[model samples]
Target: MAELSAPTGREPGLRAVPRPDGTMPRALVIGATGYLGGRLVPRLLAAGYAVRVLARAPERVRAFQWGDDVEVVEGAAAEAAAVRRAVADVDVVYYLVHSMAAGTGFEEADRRAAQTVADAAAAAGVGRIVYLGGLHPDDVPLSPHLRSRVEVGQILLDSGVPTLVLQAGVVIGSGSASFEMVRHLTDVLPYMPAPRWVRNRIQPIAVRDVLHYLLGAARVDPAVNRAVDIGGPDVLRYGQMMNGYAVVAGLRQRAIAALPVLTPRLASHWVNLVTPIPRSIARPLVESLQNDCVVKDDDVDALIPPPAAGLTPYRRAVALALGRVEADDVETSWRDAELSGVPSDPLPSDPDWAGRAVFTDARSARTPAPPDRLWAVVEGIGGENGWYSSPVLWALRGWMDRIVGGVGLARGRRSRRRLAVGDALDFWRVEAVEPGRLLRLRAEMKVPGLAWLELRVAPEGTGARYDQRAVFFPQGLAGRLYWLAVLPFHGFIFRGMANRITAAAARAS
Candidate 1:
């Protein structure tokens, strides 16, 4: 096989031609590290199809086991050259890339990216294209996010390639955006006030079922090109979804009072305040919640036999979601975008927010090994290490904060191999230490609050319980404002930090 030309800029115009490898299927998953892509690839491989992934930063998609198990090509799917190279030898091209967090330009970005993939696949003579899009009613006023999904699917269809576009709603996976929203809303808010969308009905699918559908599509002959509506056995309201999530997550049922006052914009602000999703990303998602995304038709199910791919019930899916959450093994959800190595500018700040005292409390139980073992994990806390989920994001945010007169990671600690008290650790200043028992750092960042990072060790079973916390005390409206604004981010960053430390602690032990 000759080296395929790497995509440079825009994809060139190309005609759909029969792929030479049609007899032996080879599937290429664009955004293969994503929640859907991650699971889909393994299934495809298991089903006897050769699998390849096109990742912008291949390292971010760590869940994919490499080393001859899968082929990983590093490049942006939006780039025509990259897409062309990725599709050249593959029979099936899975268009799984979307810019949900790209904000206002998301639609245009999504369109261009889809066009690039379609054009590249067409040029490469790919056998078929499989696209997964959010389900929406054509008559209903679709939110920009959902509309982009529908439009992008159209782009793939326009490519003239056999396309199996599966339109789904509210995938019941632990890392899915809709599921995360429900998780946070139900877990954190015991008493809730929400938008009218909460009353809207939606059909949820388990991530595994989604993977089954995609894998089945890959195995079937290219004749099945029609758009399909795939969903779980149950249809429930967004409110019921929240109730189900709470029940599964071990939280009490939450009573939500639907308020007309909470517009999408306001709700986004509130969501951004509570969840780790930024306002830019949360607004579009919140707006889309207005659309009722229940599956309208099941005609495609007849074409693809349901027995071939068994479905998991909504309750079972919820149970799996809970199990994943407790185990913290969620990989490749839409939230992975934030964790990807995208450089996000620091959000604007207020001058009045100056001179506010801040403190952060982080506790980590150490193993028998030296703190160096732990620092190795701490040092790699946010970027490619995934903070263990996605560390690129953690480092990016920490870097941005540091640049804005906040403690960037430059003050992290002493050496990656050594640890001591009063040592300057990245943007943090060491304040207290007791050999291997504890290490505390007082925040020196600019904020209208107090912050601190403390790590303490204790025995748990045969290992140690590593608890990492970021505590913030607001000064006034500014301090309170800042806390609310970055609440959603705390969930991801904090959860990631804890997971990374725990993993590192285990490795050292």
Candidate 2:
């Protein structure tokens, strides 16, 4: 394929068009699967740029709403050929990929990845590069993570590309690392024995503001190529930020005591135990918090004008993040980028059922209703609609889950009538959804083993056959004991559930 032409020194405000014979600037987004990158792609598309993404595992981002809109180049950033292909014929390249969560040797790996992209972009004659880096004062010693970001930014700038590096502190948005840390810390603990770093001043920027700056970078003049520091209007201690979040979330003010003895290692371990954030990523972030990260320059403000409504405040940003959680509209999460390191293929077909101690309770009932009716009844199984069979028993289970730090049943469904692949349905997440045919829910509730409840409807002689299967993959002796302990309840719950669903379908029919 012929390389797309770079953006000419054309008239300002001309949006890029994706035409075969037009001079539309093509923007390539590396790390499109990350939180900010995932959100930025849609904004770029709306701004009339033909966006393309480079991802290691394209399947991971296949669930994105804009997955089909952008072209995907499947390869790792470490590969020279892959980087060349990704940087090919692009007017601007957003280098948003980072490897901090890859455990050890991430700094060197990050530098190598940045160098590869920088060399590739230079070779491709790319017009410009936009990168988001950490905000840290030059006087203070930087943590390994923050230092790596600074190094990466310098590498891009030294590549002779007109690079616009935007340095930001904690991003206050749903699924952002900083926001998640604040959210989990505030929500889980009423009293915190935090480290001295919690008292350090930090200026957080809303994700919306960050995206606005990023989008505006594309329109920035090529001559204005330098690092710009951007942050929210509020500058407060990390503990105060958590307090503000609690206020917005309608939770009681949490009491936090600063302890000088608490090291970053201890804090990271505490975060790992309390929040979903792993120790590997949380350790660096915790260490970075020791230095104040409030922005010191207004260069970005001069380059990119503020949004129409102005920058969002910390409290409002917290409210917005919580609102997304409440509405179940979280666009992307930190968990999405955490690769499982295992193939996500479907369960094996024709498995040795006898070789493994797989326990399953399969129940089938012929319903007078059609498949659609049966499927509707199956789809509306949890949330406000209740479990159809035992409401009290389900509530008890949910309470148990909550006590154990599971999501429990409070999240509910995004829509009571509709279901999607990643939607939360009470204590279970919708793993697979097939309209009028099948719905598989993976249990998120606290349990000793992995469990799935699958419902399938098939055409019968005149109506449909409702099949409900409870499959459990035990881990060890504890898992087996757990199954045995719950064996009696399964007989009552599963059997009752199957009968009630069939009856409900019949009524609906």
* lDDT (10s digit) by residue, model 2, range 71-100: 999887788998898888898999997765
Off by over 4 Å in 2: 1-22, 340-509
- lDDT for 106 in candidate 2 is 78
- Give one digit per residue, the lDDT tens place, for model 1 in 319-362: 88777666545544444343212222221233543675544434
- Please report the candidate that would top lDDT against the real structure: 2
Give the TM-scores of the predictions, in the order they appear.
0.67, 0.75
Q: Largest TM-score belongs to which candidate?
A: 2
- Model 2 poorest ten-residue lDDT run: 1-10
lDDT scores for all predictions?
A: 0.65, 0.79
Off by over 4 Å in 1: 1-23, 61-63, 307-310, 338-509
Clashing residue pairs, candidate 2? Answer: none
